[model samples]
Target chain A: MALKFKTPMLDELEKGPWPSFVTDVKRMAARKPACEDWLGLMEMSYEHKEGHWKHGGIVGVFGYGGGVIGRYCDRPDLFPNVAHFHTMRVNQPASKFYNTDVLRKLCDMWDRRGSGLTNMHGSTGDIILLGTTTDQLEPVFYELTHDFGMDLGGSGSNLRTPEGCVGMARCEWSCIDTQALIYDLTMEYQDALHRPMFPYKFKFKASGCACDCVAAIARADCSIIGTWRDNIRIDQEAVRAYANGELVPQAGAHGSEKYKLDIKAEVVDLCPTRCMEWDGKNLKIWDEDCTRCMHCIRVMPRALRPGLDTGATILVGAKAPILEGAQLSSVVIPFMKMEPPYEEFKGFVEKMWDLWMEEGKNRERLGELIQRMGLREFLKACELTPDPRMVNTPRFNPYIFYDPAEVPGGWERDLKDFRSRHQA
Target chain B: MSEEAKARIIEWVKQQKKTKHYFNDLCKAVPEIKMMQAKKIINELVNEGRLKYWSSGSTTMYMLPGQDDVAKEEKGMN
Candidate 1:
C-alpha cells in the first residue's frame, strides 16, 4: 500500500542526546514519497561512505535558468524509486507572512504535481519543495506562478532570495518599513533572481535595527539595516526608574542588596563610545559618537528610543565562503533614504552587479573580489564618497590614508580648517 | 641560494612532467639543494607564475603551470 525501504545505517544516527533528523524523516515518510527518497538517499550515503546524490543538471522551467536544483542518485540501480529528487524554490512572501489556507493550498499543489515533502521556509527564505522529477517541474511551475500567484526564487547564482524581518508591521522598535522595501526589491529584481548569470550567488537581508534580528550584516552580500541618523530620544524619568533599581529576594531566599542599582555598571560602562553619562540625576548621550549599535536601546528600551529620522545603512561584500574566508558586510552607504520604489538602492545594486560581472572570476564571491582588489576601488567605481561612518574597523595604519592630499601635517591643517568653517 | 642552485632547482622542477613534487621530494632529488634553498627557489618560481603550488589535503605540492589535467583530480574547490 505504501513504499517501504530498510535504513539500518540511518537508524544508527538516532542515538545520543540530540534528537536525530532520521527520526524526523521517518515520520514524514509515512505518506510522502519524497520523504522516502530523501531517507533512501541519506541511508545510501551512510552505506556507501559518501553522498550518493549529484547536484546541478540542466533541469528548469521554461524562460527561467534557475529556481530549481536537480539532484540524481548515483546508485539508481539499487534504489530506482528514489532516483530523481529535484528541488523547486517558490518565492516567499515578505516577512514570511502566510495564511493557513494559503499554506494548505501550497501543500496540495506540491502533492498533486510533485513531492509531498516541503521545507516551509528554507535558509534562503524560499518555500523549498523537495524531490520531484523533470516531467513535473513545468506543471508545478505553471500552477504555482500562473494559477496560485507565486513566483520562483533564485537557485544558481545571479541572486539568491532577498529576506526581511517583520518590521513596523509587527515590531515596535522597527526604525523603518522593512517589509515594503523588501517586497519592492524582490519584485524589481525578479529577473536577476531567476537568471543564473552571476560569477557567484548574491543575497540581500534587511534588519529593522542594529539588533539585527535577521542577522543581515553577517549573512547577506548586501545588508540593509534600518537606523536613525538623529540623536536617540531618551526619557530621563524612565532612565531614573530603571537606574533606581528594585529590591528582590536573594537566590538563597532573603531579600538582598546584591541586585542593587547596577545600571551604571551594566549600561553606562558598556557603551563603546562612552557617549552615555549618569551624573546622579540624568542620563545623556553624546549623539555625535553614537554608532547606532542598539546597545543602549536594548539595555534601556523603555528609556531610550530610536530617533524618528530613520533610514537604512547599506553594507556590502558579505558571504559564507567559497575561495576566501567568511566576511561580514562592510558599511558602504551609511545612511540612505528608505522610501517606496527604492530607486537609489536599486541603482546602487545594479552598479555592484555590473562591476562584479566585469571583473569577478568564476565562482568568486563579491567579498573575495573586493579582498583581491580594494574597497577604495569599489567605492570609487560606484561613485561613493567615503565617510567616517563607512569605516567598520578602525583604520590603524598611518600609512593608509583615505585622502592622499591630507597626509603628513595636512591633517592638522584640515582639522583647523574644519573648525574655522563650522565650529568657529 | 646561489644562481647555479636556483637554475638547477628550476630545471629539476620543470622535468617533473605533469606530476607534483613536494619540497622534501625536490630536496631528495636535488640532494645538493638544502631544504631552505629549495623552499626559496619554489617560492620565487611560484610568485613568477612559472610554477603552480596547490595544497592537497595537508600536503602542498608544486608543479609547472598548464599541467592542470594532472592537478585537477586532486584539486577541490579551493
Candidate 2:
C-alpha cells in the first residue's frame, strides 16, 4: 500500500524556499512506504494535539554500542535512511592517507546494506550512516573495525569528534602538523567520545596555523591553533621589487603613490623588534621577535615569509548559542610540542573535559562554564601551574563614595540653613 | 465573516486600548485580518474622526480623543 502524506502549512515555509525536512522524508518514503506515518505527524506539528508520537525517540545503529541519541522525527518513513540508522563517530586515522579505493568500498557497502544517503560528517564529528536496520548493526560494526580498521566517535554527553585543518600536505602557511594532533587525541580519548556522562557537549578542533580556516574560533569548545615563537623571514629583494613598482601589492591602495609611500614609511619603518631593517641597498628582517602578525608579510607578500620551529597553541571555550553568544576561543595552553601519538595534547584534552564535566551546569557548554567560573578555577582544578602568558587580568576601578553628613565642623549647619531657604 | 474572527478582532481592539498600543500593534494582534482590511478600517475611523492616529517611524498608532477634556470645554462655553 502507498502511504499517504500531506504538505506542511504556509507559515512553516516562511523561513526558506524549499522545506528541508520534507525532502529527507520523501527520500525515506521511496524506501519504506509504511514510514509515511512520520510525514503525517510533521504536517500536523502545529495543530497542538496528542498522538502516538510525541517529541523524542531513541535510535540505535549497528556496530556502535554507546552514544545513541534520543531523536524525534515528525515524519519517520520520509527519513527511512535515518529511520534505524544512527551516527557512528569513527576516530580519523593518525595520518589522513585515504586510499580512494578503500573509501569507495566503504561507500559501496553502506549503499547496499544501508541508505544510499549519508552525512560525511555528523554533528558529533562521526561518520553518519543514514539508514540501517537493527539486524545489520552488529555485522556492519564488526566489518568496519575488523576489516576496515575504523573506530566510532562521541555520541551522547561525551567529547565529540576532534577535527583539524589540512596540514603541510597542500598549504605552505601551515607551521605544525594538525592531522597528527587530531589522530592522537582521537586514539587517546576514545573512551571519552563513546561515553555519555557529561553535563553537555564537548567539541575540539585543530588548525594548521592561526589562520583558523576550520572556524575553530567559533565552532569548537576547545581549539588548538598552530603558531611560532620565532620571527618572520623577510627578503629585501622582494620588498624593493614591490617598492620600485616591479611588483604590485596584493590589495588596498598598492598601485597608488600615496599607498607605496605609506607601505615604505609606516609598514617597513614600524617593524617591531627591527624585524624589517633597510640598509641603503636592501631590507632585512631580524627573524627573532616577529610575533607572526603577518603585518609585514601582508604588506610586502613577495618579500616576507613565516619562520620554522613552530608548534601548536591550545585555546579553550569556543561554542555558539549554548552558553551566552558566539565567542572566539581563548588561548589556554600557550604552546605545546606537536608530534604523532601526542601524549601532552591528549593529557590536556582529558584534564579540560574532567574539569568541565565536574563543574559545568545543565545545558552550559565548556566555554560558558569557563566564562562563569573564571579560567583561574579551571587551571587550578586541572593542576596546571598558571603561566605568566596565560594570566588574563580584567581591569576594573573601585569607587568610594563620601557621605556629606560626615564633613567636619559647621558644614552641617550651613547645609541645614540652605535646605530651609530652599524649602518651597 | 467567522464569529471567532470577529471576537478576535474585538479582543485585539480592547487590548490595544488598554495597552495604549500603536495601530500596527493592533493589526499584529489580529493576524487573521488582512493588511488591506486592517488599513481600511483604521482609515475609516480616522476619516470619521472617531479615532486619532499618531505616526511613529513607518508605523501608526490609534487612540480615542480625551472625552473628559471635550466635556469640560463644552461646560465652560455654556
Superposed Cα RMSD, model 2: 21.2
Least lDDT summed over 10 consecutive residues: which range in candidate 1 chain B? B69-78
A261-336 per-residue lDDT for model 2 (tens digits): 2454757666654566665557666655454555676666677666677887787888777449888787778778
C-alpha lDDT of residue A19 in model 2 = 55
Two-chain DockQ for each candidate model: 0.02, 0.01
True contacts kept of each: 0.00, 0.00
**Which regions of candidate 2 deviate over 4 angstroms?**
A1-58, A61-97, A123-125, A243-291, A295-302, A384-424, B1-78
Best by DockQ: 1
Interface RMSD for candidate 1 relative to the native interface: 16.5
Give stretches of model 1 more than 4 Å off. Answer: A1-3, A12-20, A246-261, A393-399, A402-424, B1-78
lDDT of 1 by residue, A8-50 (tens): 8878889888988777778767777667767777876787789
Q: Residue A278 CA error for candidate 1 (Å)?
A: 1.8
Name the TM-score of candidate 1.
0.76
